[model samples]
Target chain A: MFVTPGYAQETAPAEGELQTEIVHEEGGEAGFPPFDTSTYPSQLLWLAITFGLFYLFLQKVVLPRIGNILEVRRDRIAHDLDQAARNKEEADAAVAAYEQELADARTKAHAIAQAAQDAAKADAEAERKSVEADLEQKLVEAERRIAIVREAAMKDVGTIAEDTAGAIVEALIDRKPDDAAIAAAVSQVR
Target chain B: MAEDPIHQFQISRLIPIEIGGLDFSFTNSSLFMVATVVTTGAFLYLTTSSRGLVPSRTQSVSEMSYEFVANMLRDATGPQGMRFFPLVFSLFMFILVANMFGMVPYFFTVTSHLIVTFALAMVVMLTLVGYGLKTHGARFFKLFVPHGVPGVLVPLVASIEVISFLSRPISLSVRLFANMLAGHITLKVFAGFVTTLSGLGAFGVIGAVLPLLLTIAITGLEFLVSFLQAYVFAVLTCMYLNDAVHPDH
Candidate 1:
């Protein structure tokens, strides 16, 4: 619907001038504009010039700039990605080292615990053995004393028996017996 | 008047100049060609001036265009084919910008002309042939011969290949020219209908709405065609360059 001023002005006198313009066109003043050979030289020349200039501009200036920008961006992204990968690798290594250290500490703690337990068990066994030996020695000493006391009591019993016998004889005969005889009589009775 | 759709394509001399007794007067087509070049060059240069690691919106657009063409060329021709990147990129941007400029109501479409498109196609063809010969010497003609063909039919197949190879520029040029020419004419005709109908009474005004809607739709389609044609031209150039690079296959 938008018409340029030139078109509007041309169409303004359309009722009268349109027929004349058609006549003028039919009179072989001009043919189809595209088929007209006269314009080819200028069009080709200008096309060559402009297209040549455009090609040179693009090849020399525009493309390389854009290519450089894209190349730079690609490199930057690659570098950033590489840095990120390296950082991740380092973090993974750190985590592995931490886990290894944790495992080593856990093994060391287990060994220390095992050693302490063994030492405590050995100490308890040694103490128990020493106590048992002391108890055995005390029992032997007590048995020796009891055996001596029993022998002494046995000697006294013999003496008392002989004295009884002597006292009975003395009542009857009114005399005391000899000590060696009493001992020999006691020994014969044993 | 908008009544004559062809009126828009007429090239009038802006500043007439004669060089070497030739009709080298600068026409409107030339003007728009220069405009397309300037626009493409300025846009690319200014947008990427900052060279930001993180691109701005305009810079992103410029970078996207570069990558798009680079990827297209690389895909078609591989890394060795990348030497033709400047030519391919220039052709794509020129055609695209020129077509877009044509979409403006009163602006001349440089690519709508057969001479221009033909010239552009020839440029590509010449580059292909020149590079092929320079790199492969007499072996460049192998492009016309398929890899595995009957020995008896070799001449026939090779001739057919040569014909097709020669028709590349014509087909490429005509395709773009015809598309632009037909699309613009259709749009102008439909828009002219709207104008003619609106000149009638109220019922005619109501009828004009349909064509107005169609004109809008076709204009949108034309924009798509413009970009599509540019991409087709560039991609085809890449494919042709591939043939030049690896003629045996």
Candidate 2:
């Protein structure tokens, strides 16, 4: 607020008097137009009307519309996120179910294979037992045959020794050994 | 004709209507005020009426302004300040339009008037007081007391703070009024200079060019001032309201 003293361009005949009157008419006496109190009520009233209507309009219509748009956008974003999470969870559950089914199938396949392996082992054991039984029967028959041959050889040896002893007695001293004596001597030698 | 720059500010009655000694005659200021409101209202309404997901240009501008003031309020007073968004937003838009509208040749600058701006400042101050009292009860008085003041200095500091607090409306109103008044008066004085200088024949035309260019430059500056003053007024209102909301020294 620098008050520029005064200058005159109108309603003057001389510079000094015109300057004073200019100050008197417009510069000083007129006051700052804004500070003029008489116009306060009307300006204030209009301001009140304008500002009040504006505030109400904003609060009631304009702001709410903008706010609603923003809010709707935010809610949409949140909803999309929630839906994506739900989809992810469902996918995870589906993967879990698929893995569980695979595991069950593997267990069942293993059980079936194990049963086949056990049956094969049992069949091999039975075949080995039968073969052992047949070999034992054959060994028993051969041992019996050898025992018969030994008995025949023992009877022949007794007969041959009796004949030789009779010949030797006739030739040496005109005497022959009896059957019971020969049998006793051969038995002692065997 | 001697150009009287002061005559431009004269408040002539356009439609004189006196009610019980009250001069509520519809004046030029009132006309511009209505124009500001209607223009603001219509622009906002048309732009936002679509509410498109991807905003149009006008919608973008409106939304930017809305968010700008909203953020300022929120920054100053926290989330609690959002309740006063309509108040702050309207003041900002109203003053901004009024100031800018005044820059037009032969238009009334409503914000340039002391009575108008003072009323606005009073609205801000009274709203602060009313809300402060309502929200904090008697604790709002704590704003006048400095938090870390020594016991000996408390009274002095408190008195100063109280005076500062009380002067908010005066300073707030005057700061805007003075700036607007000065800018307009300077512009008019220069405009008058251009005419007066050109009246002195060929040599005077050469002299008149400088004031003409300067007036253009100042006109641009006034445009900026128009926006800056509105921004400052709104920011100060936010700060004062912050004190009311928090009221902590």
Candidate 3:
């Protein structure tokens, strides 16, 4: 394949001093055998050998190694990205869940606070009614006792006044006291 | 045809100059090579100077060529082969330019010569050896011996591998130069035949017509061969460069 056209038998001058010759020795000689000049070298032959060897390298060594590196790197990168996305989603979900729990807890706390406030208000109202009832009963009893005392005192005063009136009448007339008047006064006193 | 065919290969000298026992004559071939270099340099520089995010048409083509070889190298020799991208790309450009240059009316095809193609092949061969050694050191020799081969067959296998290795430069250079030279010479010979026959009278015209048609067909075929030759050269270089990068299985 490396032959130059300048030295071809046809183009070489008949008397040209240039050492241009194509030597084809049929008998396999001692030195390197000259290439076959009668027939053109089959391009397919060299092409096949070249392609075969090339394919071998590709299939066996160069491509496999490169492909492996790329495949592994791709898988690793993809896995890392997937893991990151998953972690982000999980974090987001956790935050959402925590926020939801906090809101629920806050709502429960608010309800509890409202419920406690209502209970306290009801308890206070009941205590106020019961204490008012107690105070009213004491006031009525005191008033009844005071009325009784006052009526007794008033009766005594009436008796004393009648007795005195009788004494005064007897003295002024210079006569002894009468039993009917004394009995009437005593019955009045009783 | 000249009595000496070698004399026909020489393009007329532009300026006759002798320097220090050397025939430092400027020939048409030298002019084209210079033109090629200048043209290529100017083209790449102009196209790539303002390499924008959105490329110009020329810039796009240049980048495509770069990427084409870059991808080929990477595919053939793995990522390790990317370092040789410049060499391979330059080679592809130079050889393609040289090959196409030959198709012009008054230009010489440097690649159609043995010395040029041999030098290119030698570079590739030397590079292959140098890189293999650099990469693998003394262990590079172990490429000849497959691991699973029986010990008894070691000698046979080693010999075959060495012959194959040594033949790389020879095959690489011959394939390119031979195809171009053969096609061109055949066209020239047919053209000569046509013109020679037409120099005769009326019946000669009919005889000349056939050779003219054949020459036309051959010219078209040569054009196709030029592209094919360039492709083959580039592809083979890729394979050899592959060997350099990775010698083992």
Top-DockQ candidate index: 1
**Model 2 root mean square deviation, Cα atoms:** 7.9
lDDT of 1 by residue, B44-133 (tens): 999999999999999999999999999999999999999999899889999999999999988888899999999999999999999999
**Chain A TM-scores, candidates in order:** 0.79, 0.58, 0.60
Model 1 ranges with Cα > 4 A deviation: A1-21, A27-29, A168-174, A178-190
Tens-digit per-residue lDDT, B1-249, candidate 3: 222223223333444545555544544444555555556555655665564445678866666666676677788899988776656766676677767777764356656655456667777788888989988997788878767889999999999989998998889999997887777678767877787789898899889999999989988888888878877888889998887787775
What is each candidate's fraction of native interface contacts (fnat)? 0.70, 0.55, 0.00
* Winner of 2 and 3 under TM-score: 2
Which consecutive 10 residues in model 3 chain A have the weakest lDDT in total? A30-39
Each model's iRMS: 2.9, 6.2, 15.1
Number of residue pairs clashing in candidate 1, backbone atoms closer than 3 angstroms, sequence gap of 3 or more or interchain: 0
User: Which one wins by DockQ: 1 or 3?
Assistant: 1
Q: What is the lDDT of residue A129 in candidate 2?
A: 90
Q: Model 1's A-chain: what TM-score?
A: 0.79
What is the clash tally of candidate 3? 17
What tens-digit string does per-residue lDDT give for candidate 2 at B100-174? Answer: 988987777888888899999999999999999999998999998868889999899989998999899999999
- Looking at chain B only, the TM-scores across the models are 0.98, 0.98, 0.88
Ranking by DockQ: 1, 2, 3
